[model samples]
Target: MTRYQPRHTADVRDTGRRLLVRGGAAATVMGAATLGLPGAAQAALPMLRYGSRGSAVVTLQKKLRTLGYSVSTDGIFGPNVLRNVKAFQRRAKLGVDGIVGPNTWAALDRATSGGSEPDPQPEPSDPKPEPSDPKPEPKPTGSRPMLRPGSRGSHVTYLQRQLSSHGFWVGSIDGSYGHLTSQAVMCLQKTYGLGRDGVCGPNTWSAVGRISRPRAAYYSGNGIEIDLRRQVLRVVEGGRVKWAFNTSTGTSRTPTPRGTYRNFRRVNKMDYSPLGKLWRPVYFYRGYAIHGSTSIPGYPASHGCARVSNAAMDYIWARNLAPIGRSVRVY
Candidate 1:
């Protein structure tokens, strides 16, 4: 319903309205529940206050974000969140105690759902010449032409359609490779550790084809597993893979640990020592974490830290997929 480049995200509800793009459009992946209002995409919304974390906090952050508030939806409600809540309450004329009670949640729901802002109109282009040259340049003949910015057609439509189906929002499916589509493509590229060139090429297509969700396993609760054999990270919840993303693990010399661990801490943006700039890091061990990266190759490559695309990491944060104390089986 809205489009934005990641404020560095620029974030949902539940009978959980899991917005998985299927077919040529976004098919709402719904779970068991009842007839309800919007916000089903998020699992649920609980009362959030200082020191709160998890999906509820994520939902609150997203609602605040959609209303033009600058807050990181990292699922951690620290002082920044508290301050934002107070600011919002002041604006809404509610009690300004910084506690998100029923009133705050209701106002957030109303604000985000009140109406739709029209998509920005494209800038006027230079006047074009008459259609004397009908044939024009020859189209690139391939199973899937390498799509870049300024490209358009049914093929573009197909690409856009497929992207949206995989939960990557490319704005609209109008068969136009505009900025929104480009951002989506960039995200997709980063998800699998491909070059962040925003071009839908062979590698991107392969990753797209390999897109899948995780399946139930021995674990009975929420956790994350990085399959070395498959080079993918599975987001396991309640014995089922809610979502999956392509990943590039550590190289042989600096291999990842093959054991069960728990996410001990989280940093919304980490640049301490050797970690570099981890957009949203969920630490499963000391130093080693599943973090967003700019250079994620199909093959193993990190300095022992399991790597995911920045886009994938952003989704993880936006959805609170891997909260602290969650199981992380890396085998």
Candidate 2:
């Protein structure tokens, strides 16, 4: 079972709005270009950048934030905002294709005022398929949702979209948690040394936002991502954030937990031992660990121990921590 988390204020609402309005989909607001010409060009908003600092980004961010998207109006298009966008898109049932196109814009317009959800079912305009002389190339394998930030829909879709923004492709944003999404999620878990289950919950989303920040590094085929606000751990690897699980810290957990902790050890596969004080085997470190549990339910679940899934334990066992001496820090 994979855990997930949300990264925004609870006051936020899921008002599915299209961010883009295409040429014939809605009324147009045209403008003229330079050279003393009228009606020369049409104006459209560009794709929002992550952690962007500007008026446009701020306006968009505030709007999204108000609508229950976990994005900040910090004038920067950060990971949080991207997650928000993906959430909005998903709820609207628009293509989880991640791009902020006309369909997205139209939805956004309705979302701002707490409007009702539009019908996202595919239209049957039935354009005739053009015959191609050359055969089309085979599509890529693996199902990663093309979801972007601010899409509206189910929590699962929301989680998948957030993961995609943080460099983990979870397959087509079809609102289904299939194998491809799970594989991408596992990649994130392996990188961060978390249990490699493919479920997206509060813990996983928190890790996704944190890893997007600076200072997250890849170590000996594994990595860790820390969320300052939520105080959790996210495993990553091979340029993708793998899995996210909970952890515990020292009595004076504040400053120490703030910094990143690199992999120091990996405990491998073991037989189920009821005699042990754990539901699963333990992976020990200097004084901490990434292990399994039968009682971990929420944040601060371990005694500075990084609790992970049994699968994650097995993965680390097979793949030793080659970067055992890397530094972990907090911001």
Candidate 3:
């Protein structure tokens, strides 16, 4: 005769405890193994950017050095690390945002584990692939509607991509033609001698296809050059215009001083002066700076400081493109 009975509470508790201990031990082993391998550890790593510090930064620096980048594993994410990250991102064909997010970390893992070469300075034009033949221009189809602000669709996204590929910053390709898209279109129009209507019409599309990289007046240094007449800003690197952005300089009442000056000071947050609020100001002269502004019209509208879109200023900050002591040439 057998008496069927449920397991006692103590027995169940003991079995549960044993399982928990075994699971924790297995987890500990897995964690140790993951930390031993770079690629495996990347999934649990946090994003590293400027000003980040700790053991994670050390890991990033070590991985960067492994990929032949000259970065010190001092557990500090400084300007040098930011530059190396940008260079690596550019090399990996990823967004050159200088932030070691998940995508960047994955790219680093692939490059290091796959036995890729060192971080060689790629040609400026390597990222941008130009068509071999410029003769056969892209004809606009009838279905291509004229893009204006507030238009939302894939066509607007295509327009944004084209403008970005042409080196005009359109903020983001969100499939919506917003203010930034309109501003970029106006910049393209201004560059190609087209009418600055801020509308993407047939002529604008044609110019987008035919235009080449805009050249800066001062092509001998790494700095920022502002074309007052064109209302455009050129970021020059190694004597080439790496990027161009639409800017609004000082109005006629108070002109942006025309001279070559190094960025003597900088404020990463919104700065208040007697004139108005300036976002992330990079001061070149006594009171004038290249700052982000809420209102950056196509013409000279600022009181004195050069005004660019807030997003553009952020891009400049992220890349350290206009660091302290960097030259700023205004003409």
Q: Which candidate tops lDDT?
A: 3
Point out where model 2 deviates above 4 Å: 1-229, 236-264, 269-285, 312-331
| Candidate 1 vs 3: which has more TM-score | 3
**Top-TM-score structure, candidate number:** 3
Candidate 3 error regions (>4 Å): 1-138, 141-143
True-vs-predicted CA distance for residue 324, candidate 3, Å? 1.2
Descending-TM-score candidate ranking: 3, 1, 2
Per-residue CA lDDT of model 3 for 11-68, tens digit only, reads 6555555655777855544554433544447656788889999999998886665553
Instruction: Compare candidates 2 and 3 on lDDT and give the better one.
Output: 3
Clash pairs, candidate 3, are none
Give the clash count for each candidate. 13, 76, 0
The model with the greater TM-score, 2 or 3, is 3
Q: What lDDT would candidate 1 get against the real structure?
A: 0.65
- What candidate 1 gets wrong by more than 4 Å, as runs, is 1-154, 163-220
lDDT of 2 by residue, 1-331 (tens): 4877655522222211111133332323221222213332223455554545577677676555344333434677665556556766877878765555566666776666557652121111214332231333222322322322333345445555555545443434444554445544555554455654545444444455455422234444445654533444555565444444333332334222444555554333333332234322333344454554433333344455444433333333323322455444433
Cα lDDT computed for each candidate against the true fold: 0.65, 0.44, 0.75
C-alpha TM-scores of all predictions: 0.47, 0.30, 0.60
Q: Model 1, 1-331: lDDT tens per residue?
A: 3986433210233213444333222234243223243564332446778999998898888776555344667999997678667766765677899888777787776666653321111101214321222233333334667888889777777676566555454544555686556666665666667886678888877766675423544477778888875566777777766555656778888888888999998888754637466657888988888997766655688777877666557557755788999999998
